[model samples]
Target: MTEESDSPMTDTDSTTTGPLVPEDITADSPFTLPGFFAALAEGRLVAARCTECDTHLLPPRPACYGCGSRAVTLSEQPRTGEVISYTSVNRPPSAFDHLAPITVAVVELDSSARLTGRVDASLEDVTIGDRVELQVRDPETVDIDPDFGLSYEEEWPIHVFELI
Candidate 1:
């Protein structure tokens, strides 16, 4: 099998060129969700924690988006979680129509941070209080707005949770 990428073959060129930003993969910050994606690429699940209150932020924010605190740190989280809320989509958005009946959910990790992610389990089997483990799956290509530079456009992975 083969595929084609319209993204810049290399971002070092003097002329900054890019195809339409590809889907939701575009990330613009390390202190934001992209930083969590980067860590997922490294086979780790990390969250932002407030040094002041020890609160965990699932999609990390530089400053504790939770409490208006400037003391935020990326802290790795426990891989296990339980389903808090979820929905099974009969029709996914255009980009993901091929994956209908997808289960998307908000899972509360053991550390008390709730994260929204697609659950990788048989649709019929998903339910509230179901035990799951955070897992990383390769995204094949990571894309981002051209202004941020190519460092953000490498092969990487994102987090998904599997029923345990």
Candidate 2:
């Protein structure tokens, strides 16, 4: 499949894959703008860590929410995590119309930080506490393009224990 220039990074799929975003949808990002895209571009799952409580926070920030510590550090997270909760967006927000019925999951990293992403499996197959791996899928493979550096999708293999 052809790759899109705007994708975070292209990954070869043994099977056919689809784009994560459609050209029709247009909306501003809801999360931290540059830092989010930058992490994907660099192939690292960046998160904020509290120096005081040692809490790893997703959506990296300048301060720690747990201990109210300003001394925070940004670190790359392990790509594997456990699915704490998830939902299939059959009716997505206006901006995600191109990707309706997508699976969004809250994943708990091994470090105990919870982060969210689109789940890359069928709705019937995903379950709470399922093991998942972070992956960067090319938009062109799916026939859509997100107006960002790259869009990522999380895939959960059948064997959940493997992630640990």
Provide the overall lDDT of each model, using Cα atoms, as 2-decimal numbers.
0.63, 0.55
Lowest summed lDDT across 10 adjacent residues in model 1 is found at 8-17
Worst lDDT 10-window in candidate 2: 154-163
Best by TM-score: 1
- Summarize candidate 2's per-residue lDDT along 62-137 as a digit string, tens digits: 5577877755555566667778888899987665677678887888766667777887776778888777777765
Q: Could you list the CA RMSD of all candidates, in the order they appear? A: 13.6, 13.8
lDDT of 1 by residue, 1-164 (tens): 01321221111212111112344234643344565567677766666667677667666665565677756655666777788988888876655565677788898887777789888876789988888778876654322233333465444465678998
Candidate 1 runs further than 4 Å off = 1-34, 141-154
Give the best candidate by lDDT.
1
